[model samples]
Target: MTDRRGLLIILSSPSGAGKSTLSKRLLEWDPSLRFSVSATTRAPRPGEVDGKDYHFMAEEQFKHDVIEGQMLEHAHVFGNFYGSPMAPVQAAIEAGRDVLFDIDWQGAQQISNSVLRDFVLSVFVLPPSIAELRRRLESRGQDSAEVIAKRMQKSWDEISHWDGYDYVLVNDDLDQSFEKLRTIVTAERLRRAQQPGLLDHVRNLQKEFEEISA
Candidate 1:
C-alpha cells in the first residue's frame, strides 16, 4: 500500500455562516476523518462529554499548555480560551487519518502558519449576504438581540480573512456548499497520496513489466 500523510482540514466562518453544519455533514460523509477536539476553558454544558465534546481545562492549565507549545492552535473567543491539542493531531497525521477543525479565523491562522503548515488545507465559508446572515442568526432563537448585534458587528472581521484560505465558499445553499467541500477534500487526499514515493512505485512497476517482456 502507498503511504500518505494526512491533512489538517480547517473550516472557518462567521457565527451565522454554515461552517459548523457543513463540518457535521463532512464528518458523517467520512467516518475515518477525525474531528479535532479542541480544549476550552469554558465550563461544559449539559450532555457534553469531557474528551469527546471538548477537552475542558482550567484557565491556568490551558495557558500552561499554550506556553509549553502543546497546542497546535489556540485562540480567545467570547471570553473563553479554546485550543487544539498538538499530540492527537500529530499522531493522527502520522497515521494518515485526516483531522477536521471547525475553528475561527484566529485558530486557523495559527495552524496555517505552524510547522505543519504544509499539511494544512484551510477553507473559509462566507454568507451570501449580510441580510441573510442576520435572518439566519435571528432564526436560531438562541442568543439575545444584543449578542446577535455584537456577532453581526464582528462578522466582517471574520469575512475579511477570506483571502487567507486556500478555498472560499459562499454557503447560500447547504447541499451545494457541502458538495464543493467534499470535492475539495477528495482532491486534497488524492494529491497527498501522490508523494515522492510514487515515483519509486512507478519505477518498480516499469521494471516488473520489462522483466516479464524479457
Candidate 2:
C-alpha cells in the first residue's frame, strides 16, 4: 500500500529556474497531488483565473487574514502581499492528498517551524549557471532588462540558501530534473514518518510469521 500521511511539497527556485513549470508538470502528472493556490493582493493577469491560478484578494482582506492568524505562512515579496491560506491547505492535507507549494524559503521555514515538519518536503531547484539563468530569463521575453536584473540579483540570494532544502536538483536538463524531482516525491511518500499504517502492517505481518513458526 502507498504511504498516506499526505505531503506538503515546497518547490522553490529563483525566477527562470523552472520551479513553477516543474510544479505544474508534477501536479498534472500526479493524480494524488493538489496544487496549493496562494492568496495574494496582486491583480490577476490576462488568462489567469482567480481561485485557480491564485486566490486574488484585496490588500485589506489579506491583512485581515494575517492578523486573524488565518494564514499558514504569509510574506511580503517585491512589495506585494502573498500568503498561503491555512484553510484550503489544511483541508487538502487532511484529505490525504499531496499539496504543492511554489513558495520561497521564508514561507517554507515558517511552515516547518510551526511543527508541521512531518508533512513538509522541500526541494530547491538550481539552474546550470548564472549565465544559463540569464539566458533562460531572457528567453521568456516577458520582462524588461531592469526587471530581469532584479530577478538575477534575487537569484543569487535565493540560490545561496540551497542547503536549507531537503533535496536539491540542478536543472541542466529538463527531463532529467523532472525525473529527479518525481523520484523524490515518490520516495518521500514512502517514508515511515508519513505512513500512518506502517505499524499496523508490521504487526499483522509479525502475527503471520509467528503463526507459521508455531
Candidate 3:
C-alpha cells in the first residue's frame, strides 16, 4: 500500500477515564504510532522519566516556550501548564507516522482547531458511570482523597465538552472500546485525503487504459 499522511490522534477524557489506558494500548497495537511527549510545568511523579514521560520544565521556561509559539497546544490544568511541542509532531507527521496525544479537552480543542486541523482525529472517552470513574481514580492510589474530590468535581466540566470530539466512547468494556478505537484509526487512515499516492496510482491506470484503447 502507498504511504499516507500521518494523523494527529487526540484522545481526551476527564481524569480517571480510560484515555490514558487506551492510548497505551493503541501504541502497543501499532508501534509505528509516535506518542506526543507533552511539555509540562508540573514536577515529574515517581518513576517518570524526563523527555520520555513528559518534557518537564520550569514554569518560567514553559511560559517562554508558549510565548515563542513553540507549543502546538497548551492549557493550565491542576495549577500547572502543559502543552505539545510543535516541532516533533510536525516532523513525525510529515514522515507519515501518526502521533498520539493523551491530553485534556482544552488541549484537544486547540489542536483540532489549529491549521493542521485536517489531519486531526479527536476521540473523547467517557466513564460508564460516575461511581465507576471515582472507583478507577481511587484504585490508582496515586492521589490523595482531596485530589480525587477535585477531579470528581471537574469531571463533569470535562464531560460537558464531549460533543466537541469526532468520536465518543463510553469505556465500560476495555476490550470493546479498544477494538472500536482501532477500527476508527484504521478507517481514518484510508480516507482519500490521507492517501496522496492514490492519485499517482489512478494516473498510471489511466495511462495503461489509454494505451490499450489506442
Candidate 4:
C-alpha cells in the first residue's frame, strides 16, 4: 500500500439534520478517520476541548487568517466566525491521515475550489423529513422557539443543493447513516485517481506473468 493521501471528507447539513451526530458515530466505529477541528471565535461550551471540539481563537486572529488565505473555508453563523484552517488539514493529508470536514455548503464550495478539491469526497446529509428535523431541533433544548424556527426555515435552502455532492445520506437512523458514510470512505480509498502508482504495480505483475510462460 502506497499510503497515498486520503479523502477530504466534507459532510454538510442544516442544524438538526443529524450530520454532527452521525459524524461522531462514524468516527467512533472507524479508527482510521480523523475529524478536522475547526477554528472558532465563539466561546466554548462546557466540556469542549480547545483542540478537539474546536480551536477557539480571537476574532482578530480569525480575521487575520482569512485575510492571509490560511483558511480552506470559513463561515459566519449566528455572529461567530468558524473556519477550517489550511495548514493543519494539508499537513494531515501529507501525513496520509484522512481528514473530515463538517462544514456548510458555502464552506464546502470554498474547499472544493481550492487545491484540496482533488482529494475531496463531499457528502450532504439530509433530514428524512421536515417534520423530523423540527422534532430533532426541539429536542436539543439549547435553542429557543424563535431560533428553531429560523433553523427550520434555512434547511430547505441548505438541502436544495443536494445534487452538488458526491453522495447524500438520509439520516433517518444514526447507525445506518454511519454505515453509509463508512461505505463511501472505503470505496473512495480504492478509486483510481487516489492510486497513481497502480500502473507501476500492474506492470510489475505483467512481467511476472511473462516469466511464468517462459
Report the poorest 10 consecutive residues by lDDT, candidate 2: 109-118
Q: Which ten residues in a row have the lowest lDDT in candidate 1?
A: 192-201
Models 1 onward score TM values of 0.88, 0.86, 0.89, 0.84
Runs off by more than 4 Å, candidate 1: 77-80, 192-200, 206-214
lDDT of 3: 0.92
**Top-scoring candidate (lDDT):** 3
Candidate of highest TM-score: 3
List model 4 lDDT by residue over 32-75, tens digit each.
Answer: 77888999999999999999889999999999999999999888
lDDT per residue for candidate 2 within 1-214, as digits (tens), equals 3436778899999889999889988988897798888899988899999998889999999999999888879888778988888887677767678899988878878777654676899999999998999999999898999999999998998988889888999999998999999899889888888787788889999999999999
Model 3 reaches what TM-score against the true structure? Answer: 0.89
Of 1 and 3, the candidate ahead on TM-score is 3
The per-model lDDT (C-alpha) reads 0.91, 0.87, 0.92, 0.87
Stretches of model 2 off by over 4 angstroms after superposition: 1-3, 42-47, 58-61, 78-80, 203-214
Ranked by TM-score, the better of candidates 2 and 3 is 3
Candidate number with the higher lDDT (3 or 4): 3
Per-model C-alpha RMSD: 2.6, 2.8, 2.4, 2.9
**Residue pairs in clash, model 2:** none
Superposing every Cα of model 4 onto the true structure, what RMSD results?
2.9
- Candidate 1 backbone collisions, by pair: none
Superposed Cα deviation of residue 103, candidate 2 (Å): 1.0
In angstroms, the error of model 3 at 127 is: 0.9
Q: How many residue pairs clash in each candidate?
A: 0, 0, 0, 0
Model with the higher lDDT, candidate 1 or 4: 1
Residue-level lDDT for 57 in candidate 1: 98
